[model samples]
Target: MSELNALHDLLKGLGDEVVRSGERIVGRRNADWSGIPAVPPLAVLYPRTTREVSQALSICHAHNQPVAVQGGLSGLAGGGCTQAGDIALSLERMNTIEDIDEIAATMTVQAGVTLQTVQERAHEAGMMFPLDLGARGSCTIGGNLGSNAGGNRVIKYGMARAQVLDLEAVLADGRIVGGVRKMVKNNAGFDLRNLLIGSEGTLGVITRAVLQLQARPGSVATAWCGLADFDRVTALLRLTRNRLATGISAFEVMWPGYYEYVLANVDGLRAPLSARHGCYVLLESVGGDPARHQADFEKVLQDCLEAGIIEDAVVAASDSDAREFWNVRDAPTAFPILMPRLIAFDISFSIADMGRVSQDCVARLGARWPGSTVLVYGHLGDGNLHVIVDIVGASDETVLQVEAMVYGLVEEYAGSVSAEHGIGLKKRGVLGHTRSRADLEAMRAIKLALDPRDILNRGKIFPDELLTRRMND
Candidate 1:
């Protein structure tokens, strides 16, 4: 077929080690992580260096071949999909740790480095990589920055983009742009790194990056506290932050229903404490001194109890115990395995409006689907909440109805439909609810000017109607 011949020639052009076509799996995985996997691509290009990436992209641009830039393929959004006739450019072979600037407290790494590898390697060198998540073992630095990922410690260390210093990416036209040097203070021009960080590889392909590091933590204190209501949780957060200062790194909240669901279904896990509380908070504090940190933690707990801000609290006494305390809140394996397919969403609202919006959303979900179970929880300190609506044995129409109800109410509350995950293929239709017309127009213009051929991850971020059908598609 002409398609095979064309793909073979493109691969041959890249070099013997760079390309592969037939009988090979390429493109991004589906949203469910399996169902409806993206249609196979014309070829998969695995470039090992910046120059190779440029040349391969240049060829694709010249041919007007739609290409998807993939890092770890761990993204939940379908940003990396490619149908027949399209191509995939993976940074898999580009893994490398170029340097770790100890003096500057920064590390420069290629985009393909696994996040967990960075964390462990940096820890071994007596530094800390604060950005972490359940998927760190598989996710890549570029993927993290692409989604502006916010994990457990986001309440303290900020998002992935905040922890980054600089980056190097190849634009759609095969032009390399951005700086790689570590700069803490640069007012010379626009903050270009921020633009590339959360773009989901739509505007360009991330090749290399420099990340900011923090001092190795000397002490850690974790606790699972029970709260009478969300108001108390907010008050508890304020009280702890006021007392502990910046030492508070993680503040995770869980609604009672969620905790109960996990305990009922998850094996090898028991409810550490009674599951009757209206709300539960998992708080962690990291500091430079162990003794003082532990004392301060207890004192804060006692103060909160006396002030009626907290009902009950159990502080972890050992490292193993601390992880045990967090497992209940962090693991979502049980939810998906035991419950029916749920419409899960991560929405961010101002801290002040969290209680009202969550309550209204829950009431609406219950009314819309009586059999559906609604659970709400999140990082209270950061104003980002995770909501799940379970539609057990529901029809496709029912599932869509629940989604409409949740997202529609979220917009009314002025909350983001996606707090950290990029729009990608999954949320393209709902993007208008989150971004304004002017915002999307500017984004489209930037995509056009930089990748005029529409060769870089085409038909993503923007809707499908915006583009004329690819001649070959």
Candidate 2:
């Protein structure tokens, strides 16, 4: 009751966009393609401009209130998530593509602009903003930069962070620091933009950004192939990069279990060949001419089959067919047989150790949690794999065990516990797998220096000291 009274005047003073009570529901809303339950806040405030955001943060910093900055809510990790006694700062009202610089090939867009909006705007202006994920339709540009999101073309265009030229963010002290420059080269001291990009809203609230744009793909071709095992998958990846010698936009691999689940249940999304195999990959190449790209793709697939490196192969006959093949890869419904409550883990390892590490993780998952399915697949070309530890029930106890089993093995393999998904609240305890104690303490030191009062997305990335204090009780 006292907390409400204390925040009432401050929140009410911010204008009609800010609210204290029912605003808490902002956190309860699902924000990602992952569909994890949201950890909500006590209030939510939406500000249209950096000035309004500054005013909101000023009150929050003064009150020492924990604040979670929410974008389009499309992150896999709970970076934008809020907890009790917390307030959520919303950038939804800030959605706008402010300017398009044709010569410089950059777009200054407000943080809340949906990725698709930016993409289409770039397309209409005869350019491309190549940062893409399956969730591009609803995910915000700011959220993509926050998580340093990687998607199909990551091997080529790089992650979202690399595509960002500059950004404007509101720091913890309510000071609006605008760093929106569209320069390609600047050896100007420390790069503050990179610091805020992957900090996952913990360092500051990103309000606007100048994003780099690329030349649009004039032509693209895709092929599907079934592999013998993870070893064969890696070998084929090497072959594709070496022989195909084209723009490989995507190299998505699916496990036999995952492939079968799609083939069985997802109607209209057809598998390229009827051959049953241990793994399947949907490979893509892009170039200037569709005919040359298609012929080259067919030749590559034929060579793989001749080498007996893979079991079977099929190239997409048309654009529609290509989307159908990729739909099976992108959509969750394509893999319906996967347990409803599963821990999706993405880890990176050297190509040499990937097969053994994957096998070890699967065996451990089955032994640790009997009757649960373990689906393994990845963008093998980039040494990234996705492991899903299927649980019969998603009870807290069972999920924790699955997380430990997967992450512990990841640590054993010397792989990052998180590949694309940034380490938010869920992976805080397991970060030790990827880094040493000194590394983490140094990160904490940086955090403390950036946010002295620790009001910006307080409990995310790092475990909360207050929570520790309460647990000691």
Candidate 3:
């Protein structure tokens, strides 16, 4: 019998658990939110338990069958995407909240649990799961850890990796390593849990996690302010931090083009400011005392406005109003529906270089693609900016050119190629621009040690030939 046929026979006992039909796995095995075309895997495997996952990987390891691990399929990068002859492993069945310790302020959950579920559960327990993102309803905790995701709350709660106290993962060789620690301090030895958290499933398959939780904020305040320029925006950030300190939760910024595009394109969303400006900032503060928090927020806004630091400002009068203010900044519907053919970018740079980099981006994109539009906005509080280039009828060549131009600017500004998003197939080629030669070599060494067969998320982070060429160059 052929290898494929033999593999199928060896796994036939899985029955309905093993998805063999092509039609059923159409969108199931694809990477989350990625625009890349999906390659049908040999089969999409569903393992309900860690041991089951180990069993499947053991069989695949023996047969040398490559595997791609997928969670919510909500990732922009193609790291979770499947290739030919690869078996896709979906963690959907493993969704469960294993434990929620109110006294300890921690939650132990299966990797397949959606972030939204975790958040809601934590809220019900009078705690907050601080790791939140736009894809919370769809993205899984495992994927969040795999990508080391950061969202609006990251400025306050840190990344997904920070929120995690301990985790459990299945190795490429089907060895289950469980380290579900609940203690706040364990300074005994090396942190093996961190190795798999942001490894993008290239090192091991994450199955469960023990996440640290924070006390639910009793007071939440939001404000929308229009800024004269990036300098004022930074000043506002510094002032907010200096005054409000740890109470500040979010500080989102949008350039004129991005603010205007979303304002014009997204229906039912109105601008908070009366007049257009060069920049817009949405700030949120959370604290234990509602009255004190609101007073501090208003005082800062009023002081900034009186001091000529801000052009205009509006504090959210109610929860609904705050949601509306954020809707404009989020642009959840605008970007996907209106600008369907845009190249999205998420890079981190120094706060000081933002204004120049954004101006250079707009100028360069316009010079090259005469009619193209560049939209800029992001979590400015953390220096992670999101850029979208809208070029009409852009071809493959045009995409390559635009990517190089954008990433080139990021490199010029001494920025990272990717901020929240992992280095999937999309950003694999340009990773050298951000990472050093020694760093790349060390990462490659880890990948080789963990996955000698190269069976896990192959061709996601860094390609061999490209790494060698970059090192040589």
Candidate 4:
């Protein structure tokens, strides 16, 4: 029988978990959030348990059918997008909170569990799952692990990898490795969990995760500050790090254009401070004591103002006010509506180079794509800058040109092509810009060793042309 026929036969035994309907398996099932064209799979498999996942993979492995593992579908890159002849292995049916070890301060969750669910459950248990992002409502814990997501709380709790104590992933050949290991210290042997955490499903299929939870802070003080420039922003960041230290939860920065664009375009989002400054920084702190947290937050602002590090500042009077401040930052979701063709870049470089880099980028973008709007904003705390370019009526080639221009500049500045977002299909072609020859060789070696047939998440992380070229070189 044909591979598709054999695959269908194997999935038939798994019951309704397998979606054979061609139409249902197309569209979003084969698309990531990147707005790229979708490549529909032969079918989309919804595996409810690790055994089912392994069984599905076992059959696929035997048939030499490539598989694309999908979770929340909120990825910015095209990591989850399926290709022709490929089968999508979605963990949506695996959604569940297996256990909450309150004593150990860890939450064991299935791969398909939404981040918001994890956060809400942790809060109900008087704890906090600190891996938060704008897409937390839709993004899955497994997707977060695959991307090694670094969200708002990275300044304090670190990235998703840091938040994960251990995880269970099914190898390409259906080998289930790892389970719930809640201990923070495991010096026993090679860290396989770390390998799969950020491998972006190219290495293995993540089935479940054990996430480290922090004690829910009694107080979360947020402040919105208008800064003159990136220098002042860095100064304020240093002050908070020196004074508040681990208490600083988030330090997001937005350029004037980004601030103005959001305030003007996003309804119900009023500027907390005047948008006349060169930039703005939304600072937040969390601590055990409400009164002390607020006082410390206010004192830091007062010091920043006194030192001329900030032009103006407004501390959130209540939770509502804090949400309003974040609304302005998060309002970029209205980007699609605001601009016809928006090209985005998420890059990382030296924090000190941020001011010059963004300014240079904007200037260059304007010259290259005249009348295009460049809106810059991101988690400056960790050197991740998210740049959105408004190419209202640009062609496909124009978008590629914009990518080359921006990423070329990123490379010139010795910055990573992708910071938080993984090197999926969107950025795979440019992986060489950030990674070295040795790095690429190591990654290829790992991929070859783990999935020799390239049956797992093929057409991702490394472009086929580059892979061939590297091997020849």
Model 3: colliding residue pairs: 32-73, 32-74, 32-75
Cα-based TM-score, every candidate: 0.95, 0.91, 0.95, 0.95
The lDDT-based order of candidates, best leading, equals 4, 3, 1, 2
Question: CA shift at 36, candidate 1, in angstroms?
Answer: 5.3
Q: Which of the predicted structures, 2 or 3, would earn the higher TM-score when compared with the native?
A: 3
Candidate 1 pairs with clashing backbones: none
Off by over 4 Å in 1: 1-9, 24-36, 465-473
Superposed on all Cα atoms, the candidates' RMSDs to the truth, in angstroms, are: 2.5, 3.1, 2.7, 2.2
Query: Which candidate leads in lDDT?
Result: 4
Which prediction has more favorable lDDT, 1 or 4?
A: 4
Candidate 2 lDDT over residue span 1-473, tens digit each: 54465367556767554564564454357344445455556667878888888888877777677788888877778777666777778888899889999899999999999999999999999988888787888789888888888887887788888898889999877898757888888778888888888898888889999999988877788888887887788778878788765658888888776777666766677667777888788888877777777788788778888888888887888889888888878756444344556578878887678778877877887786777777777876666888876676568888887887778878888888778889777677777889887787777777777777788877777655422432113
TM-score of 1: 0.95
Sort by TM-score, best first.
Answer: 4, 3, 1, 2
lDDT of 2: 0.78
Clashing pairs in 2: 31-73
> Comparing 2 and 4 by lDDT, which wins?
4
Q: Give the backbone clash total of model 4.
A: 0
